[model samples]
Target: MSDSLDSLLATADVADRRDEVVTGVREHAGRIARELALLQGGDYGSRDFDTDSGTWTVKYEGGALQYLRYDGGREEVYVVSAHSPPDPEALAEALRDYAAFVEAYNAYVESLEGVLDDVDTDFPAVASTESVAAERDRVLDRIRAVSGEMAGQLHRAEGTDYGTFSARVDGTRWELKRERDQVSYLRVGGEGGIYLLSQYGNPPATDVRELVGSVPAFVEAFNERVADLDAGLSRVEL
Candidate 1:
């Protein structure tokens, strides 16, 4: 019964942020069903009115709980599901849990915004001396080491050809690529560099040019810091 309901819930489009909370609710439902022997089977069902349209369906062997919110079209903003029925108290608890999960998720997103703000405010000025070139070299070396480590980790996790991993350190832009003799880029960027992993067949040069343009500002800031550090070191009497 739990397995069947879980399978169905997996197909439901729970937004990425709410997926973990919905999964937790399903687990709680399975526990309740086990205690109530609802696994024996019956057509018992119920409906509830709340922030959204809620439907609970109990099959003879198991059941499913679904919530849907629609905006007068084919699009649904929210959908969540569980595999077992809940008593009033249990339902209340589930709602509370879901609410708390939402709060935490919102907080996490806000924290990311704060991080971006900090990065923007603290970006270093680019150096204007020969030391900038030396700093670029050092930063490139660090980028290579870190990229290699990341590639090794990905290879262990996904068993794919991370071998094509390469980094191009340009002024304030650091571009990393994992390419075969093909195209289709899987790109991610952060405060350190832009990473592109591609597996699609021979793409156009335009794709590569567009990727370089999309390099994140945080990565540029990091390169600027490297240049600043090199300039500072060169002026020191050490």
Candidate 2:
């Protein structure tokens, strides 16, 4: 008789819990279904809310509802199963709130993406100033090498007296004359009277390296003259 009485009481409890689940879903089913459709991923749309009992959270995972409760005394959060306390009604309300938060969050992300797509400005990397200066130095080193070699060749050639050198190439005459024991002068003429290539008085050197190092234009002119003299030296004498 005692077993029979216990069975009847358990049956009533089951019936009451079933009624509560049904009532909760019926009141919020439309909203829950709509939000679940928008909420994607295995675990998303998480939101927390305060309740008379404590704090509770709701989310969707793998197309199913999940509920969580925070225990302040333990400082830990644990899952609230459907067969547990706080009932399905509270879970539904939290789910609706969380889903709404998710909707707003997704809309904001979409708007930010649109704005980024319209940004067309491009920033390209460029060489540093030090790298550019290094490149210029390399070019200048090559120039110095060629000029020194040419000056040596001209110094040894015949008719190059007192470091005096002259050559006419492409209708332009370039001349470097050692004027005194300590000084020299550079001149250029093109169907007109010769003009000084060196703005100031020059220093004496057999290779004309001093002149080449000092004046930019003189180095180019001097190299051209040396090249012509070198070609002449290479020819077979008749």
Candidate 3:
């Protein structure tokens, strides 16, 4: 397997291990909270505390060692996790950081839930209207350009040897083509109408005009269909 695939597998393994460690830490913390409540004579919710500050410590030989401390002024309990043996100071800091993070995360989640509820209640109709309008405008503009090109091709021809045409008609392109006694013209009419006219005999101008005249009704019909399609699309939901 590629190195990237190997790295992805390794990342998955690390994530699983991390989750296991975190779960063990949480369970250990919960036990500490229950014990603290029993000892301190109150129901105390546990937050992770910093061990480095002389507040908490742990000793983990097999899985995880957990510790807890009390903040008397705040009336809060803190849990500390030690995956391996750590000095008192390190344990104290880790536990303190964890507690702070948990508090912040809880507040953020509450605020987000409130915002989501408000959006669900108040925004669906307005969002749908705006979405449909924007989509209609975009599709209409595209169809307009396409129809215009097809209309213009009714007046021109296309070829590579006679150089190139830079003008756009409706949404189609017109170009001229020439080969010996014959001249070919191409009119590109968006996704639907594509026409090629090749005339032989003398200057080929008469044949080209005849070809264009013969297709006048067809070209007009195509333009009408394109307009109808654009109108239909404008009425779409989104």
Candidate 3 lDDT, tens digit per residue, 34-88?
5445433555333333332233332222222344343333334433343433334
What is the descending lDDT order? 2, 3, 1
Please give the CA lDDT of all the candidate structures.
0.41, 0.49, 0.43
lDDT of 2 by residue, 1-238 (tens): 9998777644567657756755564345334433543643333565554544345444555444554444433343333445444444444454444444445544644655556577767868875667555654454455445444545556556434466656554455666555332124445564353334343532233223422344455556666766877798789587
Tens digits of lDDT, candidate 1, 130-199 = 6645554454444445444544544554466643332334433343444332222334443433334334
Candidate number achieving the greatest TM-score relative to the actual structure: 2
| Candidate 1, superposed: residue stretches over 4 Å from native | 1-129, 162-176, 179-238
Candidate 3: which stretches are off by over 4 Å? 1-92, 110-163, 167-238
Best by lDDT: 2
Report residue 34 deviation for candidate 3 (angstroms). 26
Better of 1 and 2 by lDDT: 2
TM-score of model 2 (CA atoms): 0.24
Poorly placed runs, candidate 2 (over 4 Å): 1-10, 17-19, 22-45, 68-238
